[model samples]
Target: MPFIDLKTQYKALQPKIQRRINQVLEHGQYIMGPEVKELEEKLAAYTGAKYCITVASGTEALLISLMALGIKTGDEIITTPFTFVATAEVIVLLGAIPVFVDVEPDTGNIDAKLIEAAITPRTKAIMPVSLYGQPADMDEINAIAARHGNIPVIEDAAQSFGAEYKGKKSCNLSTIGCTSFFPSKPLGCYGDGGAIFTNDDAIALACKEIRVHGQSQRYVHTRIGVGGRMDTLQCAIVLAKLDRFDHEVEQRLLIGQRYNKILGEAGVTTIVQRSDRTSIFGQYTVRVQDRTNLQKYLNECGVPTAVHYPVPLDEQPAYRDLCKAGHTPASKKIAGEVMSLPMSPDLTIDDQDKICAALLAGIKQ
Candidate 1:
């Protein structure tokens, strides 16, 4: 079975996707076509955000959001060390420091309690990544940000476009929410794409300018920026896929619930989803002993498995000296034990059963 089953999704929406592509080809406005604005509007309405700005990629979205917030060199951005490198890479790219924080062992999300302690006078923002399709505690994070001079909060919602937390969508829960459409994400396009969402009008306008070489208008360079415009064709592809996005989210929830129920009964430690939150099951991850051995056994049994992260960002060679010494125990332990099973909206129950059986056998070995 395929890991994400993107082919199946494509087959399901072939007609719509073909039609959208045909329209884009006829228009021939590849850079920023009418479909780009159309998709942005739909995403803003769906995410309950006043403005949405599409960009070249998720990294660009994060960088643009930081720029819009006026985060400067030597500023500190508090975030978890247990997420994808992009979470911290953006800070370093802008010559800002990423103050590492530990994550919860159960949810693999940033520990909100540890955030405030990491804040210093130089702290300009708090970036929390919504790992494995589950949102971080935005309410708590936002409260901390508010208490500390209203520091900007950027939610890295790359893995959690369809996720919900405390009655709000993941991308709409913070000061600036950034999500990716990197083909494998919950809501993805045909190529690299991302979006930044916010209710603040000024920040939204700044992001629009920052996305296009900091131009307020043609040939009017307003601020330092990058070429970060999302292609119109990619935007069109996302628009086509939007038709079945709600249905895909429901299927992902059902598959995740089923996996949790079966794996729990079989003595597997599934990722915990809080009562006030919903996961999109981007990875269907679990913590298991002897992860390397289990992975080999599953491979032998025709079941594919992978690791979301093999090392904490603090432990990575590039940023080891920058992180706090002797912290991130949970992140380290989870890195060694966590494994992700095959998961997708089209994943069949029979396939899941086979995967579970293989996992149980691997543990026995």
Candidate 2:
């Protein structure tokens, strides 16, 4: 089975997708066209945020957020190590130090208890990645940020577009939230796309300008920025996808809970979900010993699997010298054990059962 059943999703939405594409093609305003603003407005309304700024990709979203906040050389940004490298890459790209904290053993989210101690006078921002489609302890993280001089908290929500935390959407739960449309994500487009969400008008305005080479108006360069505008075509595709996004999110929630219940009953170690929040299951992952052997067995059983992350950022060769790795044992250990199962809104119950059976058999073997 396909790890992410995008083909089936495409089949379901083919007509809408075709119509949207045709509109874009006919308009011929491929760059920053009408579809771009339409998507930004729809996303803003969906997330309950005052503004949504679409960008070329998730990585660009993060970079632009940092730039808007004026995060510069020697400024420290606290984050979790157990995530995609793009989380830390943005920090380092702007010449900032990425101070990593360990993650919770159960949810694989950054440990908020350790975050406060990491903050200091030089701390410019706090970035918490919403791993596996569940939001990090954003309320607690925001609280900590508030206690310590109201540090800007950027939620790296690349995998959590439709997730919710404490009745709030993932992308609207922080100072600035960024999410991706990287084909395999919960809400994806045909190609690269991302957006930033924020209630802060000043930051929102700065991001809007920074997204297109810091131009306040056409040809008026107000500050340093990058050409990070998401193409109108991709926006059109996302708008098409958005037609059924809420329903898809519901499907993903049910499917993820099904995995948790089934795997837990079989005595498998599943990722824990908190009561106050909802996950979109961008990847329905679990922790297991002997992961390499288990992956091999599942592959042989025709079950495709993946690892969300295999190495903590601090332990990586490129970043080892930047931060001490002594205190991030949870991230280190989880890296060796976490393995993702096939997940998507269109994933069938029969396929889920087969995947679980294969996993149980592999674990017992």
Candidate 3:
């Protein structure tokens, strides 16, 4: 089975997508066109955020948010090490230090309890990644940030655009929320795109300026910035995809539940979602013993599987010195054990059954 069934999704939305693309082509305002603003408005309304600024990519969203928050060189940003490199890469790109924190073994998200201890006088922000389409504990993380001089909290929600935590959406839960529109993400565009959401007016204005080479107006360079505008074509594509986003979210939830049920019957450990949270099932991963052997057996049985991450960021050569010795043991352990199965809104139950059967047989062997 295809890992992410974008082909099926496209077929279902082909008419709408084609219509939107035709409109964009007729308008011919490729950069920051009408569709760009249309998408921002729709996303802001969907997430209940006061503002949404579309950008070039998820990486740019994080960088722009940090710049808006005034995260400077030598600033310390507390974050977990159990995520994709982009999580830490953005911080380092700004010459800021990423204070490595361990994650909970069950959820594979940053442990909120350890956040306060990592805070120093130089700590400017707390960035928590919503890994595998499940949001981190924003309530607890926000509380910690509030106690410590109201440090800004940025939720790296690249994997969790449609996820919910308590009564709030993932991208509306923190001071700044950033999400990716990589083609494989839960809510994705045709190509590279991302957005930053915020309720604070000042920060929102700052992000708008930062996205366009620090220009408050045309030829009025207000501050240093980058050309991080999301293309109109991508915005049109996302708008087309948005037609069935809610339905897609429901399908993802149903598929996730089915995976949990089937995997549970086979005595496999699936990723756990908390009672107050709802995951979008971006990966539908599980922890298995002898993961390499399990993957090999499944592959032989015509079941495809992949790893979300194979090494903790701290263990990566680029950031080895950033992590304290013997830190982030849980992240390292999970890296070796976690395996992702095929997941998508269009994934069929029959395919799921075949995948589960292969997994069970592989384990038995």
TM-score, every prediction = 0.98, 0.99, 0.98
CA lDDT, candidate 1, residue 255: 93
Task: Name model 1 segments beyond 4 Å from true.
Answer: 324-326
Whole-structure CA lDDT of model 2:
0.94
Off by over 4 Å in 3: 322-326
Question: Which portions of model 2 miss their true places by more than 4 Å?
Answer: 324-326
Top-lDDT structure, candidate number: 2
Could you tell me the lDDT of residue 103 within candidate 3?
92
Worst ten in a row by lDDT for model 2: 319-328
CA RMSD of all predictions: 0.9, 0.8, 1.0
Worst 10 residues of 3 by lDDT: 320-329
The TM-score of candidate 3 is 0.98
Shift of residue 70 alpha carbon in model 1, Å: 1.4
Model 2 residue 292 CA deviation (Å) reads 1.1
In model 3, pairs of residues that clash are none
**How many clashes in each structure?**
0, 0, 0
Query: Candidate 1, residues 1-365: lDDT per residue as tens digits?
Result: 78779999999999999999999999899999999999999999999999999999998999999989888788898998888999888898888888989999999999998888888999999999999999989999999999999999999999999999988888999999999999999999988999999999999999999999999999999998999999999999999999999999999999999999988998889889999999998789999998888898898888889898999999899988765453789999888888999998989989989988888888888
